[model samples]
Target chain A: MSRTQRSLQLAAYADGEVAQAQRAAIEQELAKSPVALREVEDIRAQRAALHRVFIEASPTAELSERIQARIREDRQRASGRTWRIGLASAFAAAAVIMMSVRLIGPELWHQELVSPPPLVARALAVDAVLGAHRVCSTLSDGTAHDEFRVGQKSIVEANRILKALRAMPKEGAALPDLSESKYALSSACACALVSNCEVVHATYNSADGVTLSVWMSDRPLALSGASKLRRVSGEGGRVYQVAEVAGGYSIVQWDERLASVVLCGEMPADQLLKIADRIQPFGSAARPTVGPRVAIVEMALLRRS
Target chain B: MSGKSFEEIALPHLDVLYRYARRLTPDAHAAEDLVQDTYLKAYKAFGKFELREFGVRPWLLKILHNTFLNGEAKKKHAAHSTEPQVLDTARAAAEIGSVEGDLRIDLDGLDDEVKRALEQLSPDFRSILLLWASMELSYQEIAEILSVPIGTVMSRLHRARQQMMTLLADYKFRGRGEPPNGREAT
Candidate 1:
């Protein structure tokens, strides 16, 4: 080998990364040439120095937790989209039944067989007509908390949204453990009245500008009109959902474990479902309550079931 | 496939990912962001990951490296207009004129000097050196992670070491306010 080629081999040999034969060749060259020997020594010293100087600092405990949390949020967000689409299709399929029921009679009442649980039915009926844009605009108009931002600001706004939804302690600065639902926390919110009941309007936008707006309320929603609904099994239980397209947007409305949720976006029904599926109740305080209205809806449904 | 499967296959490499990310990024915050983004992307694409065909470590590193490079390219593109290229000509002239100095590089303060020098190298060179030296990843594995040939890894590693030595030794020469020439006459 030429001197330059031999020298490169010496570097590999110093790192102990060379083959057995190449190692022997390098050792022989080192013995014959003092300059080559010094080069090898220098390389070894450099490696040693790097090993000593470079300290592999252990990441903080928060980092691993943060990473794991972010991953969970991501998976939920993705599957949630799929679930939403599935729910939407199910809702669309139920529409044919809606037509059949109309022909059959008022015999098959929405509450009797087909409607989702009560709160989900009520909020969705109102959400279909009353868009979340007005809620966001209300916040932007300075009637509520301002700064309707996304991404980094979403972290703070997540808590703000939970508070608006009454899902957390409304006063304290201590943030809820949101690693689970943190992915959908990417937007702003305001508590706005829909059909005479207060609801939290939270709009979460992905980094790529896909927006999923959620309308949530603690009050059990009563089905107002001949609402179309479908029963679909979700992560926790049998979630009732409504999927429809109106005003150039696709919307999915469902009952989460904690609140009645209505999700709207300019994407496919499935994409809207993905965001809806990820919208977990933030704290222990936000569990769904079986109120008198829900009891009445359940009684009517049970009579038919 | 399942959350348990994802945790089992991928979460074990979190430390490795974080260490390498620290080397790639400027600070802890950026490193955390890079690793978080990498894991999220990996989890999303886990359906396509064939664990039996390729190991998780190399796959995770590839994601981390790609995410970092894309962020870097974006920043470069953003700053490209504002950055002055006139300094390039001046720097090149100064590099060519550098002569070997007699001052021996002191090992006393080398820990910090070596670190500064490592950071001074381009991301490509620094990455190869870190993968080989710190992470102890094999050339074959690095080739897969970097999507480069084994021969290319070897050459880049050698050049990286040479450049590092030059930078480390040159620190003393530079302290004297002269052009650094620890470049050996090969």
Candidate 2:
């Protein structure tokens, strides 16, 4: 056998990886050649050295706790989704009953069924926003969704929506320039979450592929009965409501006069708030930076709004 | 076996996963993130994992390998860089043959030197060496984790050892008995 071939075989033998039949032949050869035997010894020594060096290298003490915490968070989100699904099924049955009554009763009853209770309407709006974000962000066939237009397309669409909102008689929130924040506008879609109300959904993607979606509406969403939402004061004494969504994602919503905005992403509430602070409305004055304590309080105060 | 939770079966391999992740990534933070991503993905797919003779370690490693590769592919696409080069086995074997000597490698007091040698290798070589030397996974298991043929694993392992030996030989001859960077040997 060639010298290199023999060397490799010695390595395998030293590793105890050689087949049974080849092992005896390698042993017989090793007995004849001192050089080959020494090579095997060297391989064994290298492996031992590797073990010694790497055994001293370990992840941080908190790594285990961090992973465990994440798993717990995921499980909680899953259970919450299950509860929401059950509630949604109940709502679906109620809707079917209302539809039957509307069809059999007067025209006024048809109008009442058409315009749902404000709380239920807001819940439906929230569901629609979440659905749009999922459909736009969900990757298909190992590629990003085609509808998630980026670059000039996203920027132009965002500007058009901003202009349309600005032309309206009431003041509206401007789409924040996320360039300084290291996130680019990936897509913007004008979706009608409520009848006659157009909500602009703008998605931003960071360099590391973290997606943040911002939904802007000209009218205030009736968020009073949304479950698990916490209200917190941001920089300009603005009351921002935050909540955890189905996938451990955070949603931060605040009302601007004639404009209501909701920011949603997989980021923690504090990070999302920081992104929110950068999103200045058209005529609002600059506000002082909030502390991490506010974020802690906001997280602690999670309740049905 | 039937009633074991995902954590019961998979959490025991966290250290192994983290060590391998450290070898794959450049920093401690990135390694932690990689391990976290691996665990999350594994937990999601745990329902589909069937217990094999080699147990959950290999399955977790396969997920880690795929996760790392996907991240690497994204990074490459963003940077518009060429694919990483695969080791040329014949040329590596020739080079290994040229380094002819009975120079003793002092395994003692060479931790830093060994780490530096490992760091200097290409990712492919480092991966193969760590799987074989550090994790001590068998050739078939290594092949399974890497999704490569067993013959490819053997050849690549030979190349990895050859490269490691070459780097260690340089350190040995240059540093003599002292450790690299004048640091006291552990």
Candidate 3:
């Protein structure tokens, strides 16, 4: 090697970076040349001087304490972030469960534990109407009833009962006029056939003495059953439950203006629904109608076997 | 890793790291800051550290080197208008034997002329000289710490020694009231 190359190797040699074989070679070259030996000595002297200069400069005594404090602070901040993330996750999970119960629990409950409200309401209406029809048939003779006095008395008695109960129909809604169907309004009174809630029982008699009974309640009646009933869509997008009761009676039940109305008779189901379509809330022409809104607890009860 | 275990294993190298940091930075406060940052980073990344044959000193040095470079980069970016050109001119002047006053003082012990000569070296050369002398790290270990090749480490150390010797010679001549560059005092 040339002198410059040999000189560069002396640096690595002084640093003790050369392999054992290279160390031996450099040592042999150093043995023959005073210039190479002096160069190595000068490098060592400079290295020692640098070591002494820097080794005397030490950090403050509190540097370690400061570093440890910083580490502790960092760890505390990380743990705080983890806690916040965990709390947020728990709240999010609870909200998801509540929304799930609100939106989907009722449907599953209806499918598994109880029949839907329309079916139970239909059956109850069938029983109540059948009983009322039997009572009215026994009470009334085959006489052509005076329409004006009975209609006027029906209104007076309905108002008196509503006043006594401290309840009013949402918009002055009264019994529908079924004169166009040849059924005259016969007798109207309050009865306790469906639950303890007061229900208005109104009977309409045709010229041939075919008896039809209608039941109206200010709130939804609570009923439970296992049998599903058929629903029919009527005019103005109203849904009606049509079902046949014992002793050849057909029932048509629907909701109007926060009141559940059930109409049942010994007539055909179609004829009953046609009569139902003619019924409307009496006072206001512009009152908005809403579908039945059953609470989740009310819809989730299991039917008694 | 647990903090206690990390302290047991790493705290012994605090003096070494601080010494090297002093060589790299301009002042004791900057050096302490650099050492604290190095320890914080090391603690965060402790889980990924494997106990190698060279131990944790080299690893800590690597973090210190990287943190110092990152700080320098941020400073360069913030002072983008004139700082870089000035640094370049200072480095060139240091190489050609004309160093500014600020780079010539600071660092206690030893002769004032020797301290000035030591301070006149650039950061890269000073780092190599410090690691090789004070820490006694091999060329391979220094290369690993600085993220450079072993050849570069060797050449930089050689050049750094040469520059230190030249600056010491100039300072010695000036101290004797003689003009530099082989001039007679008469």
Candidate 4:
């Protein structure tokens, strides 16, 4: 075979779709021709390189946003252009089942919240869009359907709710705070182009060491610092660590100003300040650039919202 | 699926999505755009999402793949460019700077050449290869994305690689001993 034909054959060979006899022929050709062999090598390297460069590229947050928008549109369209059909499931089977629309009225709400229906209703309004059928629609109960709209006040309210939850005692005390922060923070991450940290502290004793992780990605952040501990004139000494991460870095500043460790990482300085500024610790006003308190408030607002 | 609550539910995938977008769309603005589109779509469509049962990587890839393919992008932006804008790739490159444990990578100057060559393939073929590498989607997911039979997805990917090899004839690779073809490595 000529060198040109051999090159094309090499392409086919790389893709693993080449026929058995054809592969034998290519092998025979490769044994004799130096150029044919090189062509085969070139093809392999290129494919691997492409994977390296693009395979790991971060996907757009817009895709999720678009899908969300599509769902909303679909919901609206369904309300208008109903997909009418005979009740196939019930009709085909020997059963007369009638699902009720009163499921979402009030009873189940009280059970899930462990509070009276009035409390949930007073906390925030819940709008459940029912998936309907022909004639009439059945309103089904949803797990968590609360929506948080955009606005500074909305964010502040969400934070307050998050703080209340986080303040609950030891076992999963952080759960409420963590859950609330996710909705609000993810929305922000979507708006901005990167991930943000929800919390960081030495939850572990000295033996357990320090754990730093990017809240969204959950990949452990690599913490390294020349001096892990330092001494202060009046407050004495404390331990601190700086962690390395992709796209940004995190520092457990371990600020002793409040006699409590202040965990601060990379964020828009002004917004971080806004979150930190309002915290009123024990006796003092809520301080800006305050990581733990902000974490507390952010989580609270998320739960309440 | 682990029933780890909302925080643990989707937290694991943030980095993989971020990394995939950075490489697929070379421009930071484009990459950022793609990442946001993927997540926003994922968030709204979370009700339909079932993790592990339906592969998370491929499912996410399908969304991202579709986003780049059908994303309501402006007509003004160029398809792909070679210019090295600092902030866009600086962070991504720095992240993949060294493969720590199990991950092995040799990412360098070859990305532009690959991107340029892949552009020549038909849009369908282009999406197939891009999704294959980025999302690490299997043949099945590619079929779902392009709306082709699984067999067709396989055949097209094979052909796409060949077409890319042919296109590489025009471009150049950074200082390397042999051609990109795997015959040497094999």
**Leading candidate by TM-score:** 2
* Docking level of model 4: incorrect
Q: Which candidate do you rate higher for DockQ, 1 or 3?
A: 3
Q: Which regions of candidate 1 deviate over 4 angstroms?
A: A1-3, A85-305, B1-4, B52-54, B80-108, B176-186
Compared with the true structure, what per-residue lDDT tens digits does model 3 show for residues B27-103?
A: 89999999998888777667657778777899888778766755554354333222322344356445745421111
- Candidate 3 displacement at residue B62 in angstroms: 1.3
Model 2 misplacement above 4 A: A79-305, B83-104, B176-186
Error of 2 at A75 (Å): 2.3
For residue A49, model 4's alpha carbon misses the true position, in angstroms, by 1.5
By summed lDDT, the worst window of 10 consecutive residues in model 4 chain A runs over A126-135
| B1-68: candidate 1 lDDT, tens digit per residue | 33567778888888778888887788888998888888776776666566644578888887787667
Candidate 1 lDDT: 0.57
Residue-wise C-alpha lDDT for candidate 4, range A146-253, written one tens digit per residue: 122112234334333333323211111121122222222211111100123222111111122221111111111222222232322211233333322233323232
Candidate 2 chain B minimal-lDDT segment of 10 residues? B80-89
Off by over 4 Å in 3: A2-4, A85-305, B1-4, B81-110, B182-186
TM-score of each: 0.50, 0.52, 0.50, 0.35
For candidate 3, the docking band is: incorrect
Best-performing candidate as measured by DockQ: 2
lDDT by residue (A255-298, candidate 1, tens digit) is 43324555666666565555555555433433343334454676
Q: What is the C-alpha lDDT of each candidate?
A: 0.57, 0.66, 0.63, 0.39
Model 3 C-alpha lDDT per residue in residues A24-122, reported as the tens digit of each score:
988998999876776787678667777787787887889999998998898888678657655655664575477456545445433421233242332
